[model samples]
Target: MIKFDKVTKRYPGGHEALRSVTFEIAKGELVYITGHSGAGKSTLLKLIAAIERPTTGTVLLNNQNIGTLRRAALPYIRRNFGMIFQDHKLLYDRSAFDNVALPLAIDGVAGREAGKRVRAALDKVGLLNREKAMPIALSGGEQQRLAIARAIVSRPAVLVADEPTGNLDSNYAHDIMALFRSFNEVGVTVLVATHDAGNAEGRLLHLDHGALTEGVPA
Candidate 1:
């Protein structure tokens, strides 16, 4: 569902984040991108999400060239992706329910329907009871779970997570990975960028010095 053809992203200062990275991720496949810091993992994800345009080559999503997408079309392209971050990125002042509902609200989903979807997402992340609680009130694991809920609330076709388990303990990390596995089983294309090698399973893509290396089997 996503393909990168000779993709290279160079910053204004001539720092290339990705160099001729070519890969194709089929629909419903779960993949992990692993590398040390500065390996260009985040840049790869941003390219797919259209947050950063490739300096050279093309990025295709569902057969559409994203690199050439106009600014007005970016939001439509991004709606297909749900992104999670290591920082949680939750609105600390909003309730967990509201946080999860933000995407739906942006998409113009009605109150009753958004509530149903928000509650379902919270339940999937095992945070149903904390819907009214602020982000600061939750534990680290719970906060991460909340982020997961928010990401999946819109039922995105692809899920992109960057260092999702970075801030959590081993148990929490395991739980988070398991949650991702469950979503993949349900046919959501998942691409996770993590430095934690232990989480490298399924199809593994490695990066080194901005270049794409060989992929490892599960």
Candidate 2:
């Protein structure tokens, strides 16, 4: 589980991305962070994933204060999270198999074991047949799915997606949401930062001007 207590993040430029935000997300829950552009959704995700530390207050991951962690311990703490960006940060030149294999490769997982997980992840995203396909050869939805596959290839306890459906059509968006729900059903804690919930079946926390405008901590 993750918990934030009076957290605030201010950039060096004096821009406050999050101000006094507090929320608790339980294990195995699917949660959506909804808001307009510049609503601090991405910042919140980054903080939760420990990509960025809080400027003030505390961010606790299972009662461990993330902001106070030592530099060497950061990577170990981050292993609990799998992050999906809005840009679908896939390698343009790498094959689909290689793209999904990056995380396992970084973790020094052996080739045989990594290959099995990579294939399983691709199959989960309905791209098993496209293992050899390049990013340019796939559709927009396919690329997003590929990005998702890469994120989940490590099978982290928490899944954080930023605007996972922002660029897809309604049908594609719905399919992506269903995919997320499927993961949640099997007990992966999923947190999707989206502007539109679009019939999302989960707890929704809305952000406004860097503050928690709605939704209580679950």
Candidate 3:
């Protein structure tokens, strides 16, 4: 679970990215963060991931204040989160299998175990047949699925996606959302940040000028 208590983030130039934002995401819930450009959606996600610290207030992940966690503890803390981004962030030089296996490798998992998990993740994304395909050879949707495979290969507890469907056509976007819904059904907490209102599902949280708005879906 993630909780933000009166969080505020201010840059050095006197610009505030988020102002007194407060919300809680319960475990096993799927929530969408919706807002326009520069509305602080990304900043909120970053705070939960501990990529950025709040200038005021607290960001709690499973009851621990992540903002006060030591740098040495960050990687361990982040191990619980699977982060996806709009660009897919695939390694063009690597095949889909290798890309998905990277996280396990980084964690020093044995080759056999890593291979099993990698295949399982790819299977979940319906990309097992393309395991050997290079990223550039795949279509946009496949690449995004490959990214999802990579993100989940580690079996993280929380899945955080930023504009995950932004680059795809409506069909692919819906397909991706369905995948996230499936994951949520199986107990993976899912949080998505997107500008597209149609992408909102489950609990919807809206932001305007860095502030949580009354438009939040009931």
Candidate 4:
């Protein structure tokens, strides 16, 4: 569902974030992107999401050339993918349900249907009972799970998580991965970028200096 053909990215300061990277991810495949700090994993994801355009070569999503997408069409491109981040960028003032409902609302989902979908997503992430809680009131793990719920609330075809376990304890980290695994089992493509290399069992794609090494099978 995603492909990078000799893609390269260079920052304004001449730092090469990705160098002629090429890889293909089939539909419904779950993959891990592992690398040290500044190894270009985030750069790659940004390119795929069209937050950052490739300096050279091409990035394709569902066979569409993302590198050439018009600015007006960026949001449409992003609608097909869900993104999770380490910081769990929740709005402290909003309830968990409202937070997850934001995307659906943006897509024109009605009040009634939005509530139903948001609740279902929260339940999937095991946060059903806490839907009315504020972000600051939830535990760190709960906050993260709420973020995951928000990401998947729109039923995106692909989910991209960056350092999702960066702040959690081992137990919560395991729980988060388990949730991701469950999502993948139901056919949402999952690509996770993490520094922690514990006992993860997905296909591993290691990056170094913006180049992708071959994937390691678990």
- Candidate 3 residue-wise lDDT, 126-205, digit = tens: 99999999999999999999999988999989999999988899999999999999999999999998999673668888
Error of 4 at 200 (Å): 1.4
TM-score of 3: 0.95
Clashing pairs in 2: none
Q: Tell me the spans in candidate 4 whose CA falls farther than 4 Å from its real position.
A: 216-218
Best by TM-score: 2
TM-score of 1: 0.96
Candidate 2 accuracy as TM-score: 0.97
lDDT of 2: 0.93
Give the per-residue lDDT digits (tens) of candidate 4, residues 1-218: 89988999999999999999888899899999988878998898888777788999999988889878898898989988888876778989899989999889888897788889999999999999999999999999999999999999999999999899998999999989999999999999999998766688888889987888756222
- RMSD of candidate 3 to the truth, in angstroms, is 1.7
As a whole number from 0 to 100, the lDDT of residue 2 in candidate 1 is: 90
Give candidate 3's total backbone clashes: 0
Instruction: Report the lDDT tens digits of candidate 1 across residue range 126-213.
Output: 9999999999999989998999998999999999999898888888889889999999999999999988767456888899989988
lDDT (C-alpha) at residue 163 in model 1: 88
C-alpha lDDT of all candidate models, in order: 0.90, 0.93, 0.89, 0.89
Looking at model 4, how many pairs of residues clash? 0
Q: Please give the ranking of all candidate structures by TM-score, highest first, separated by commas.
A: 2, 1, 4, 3
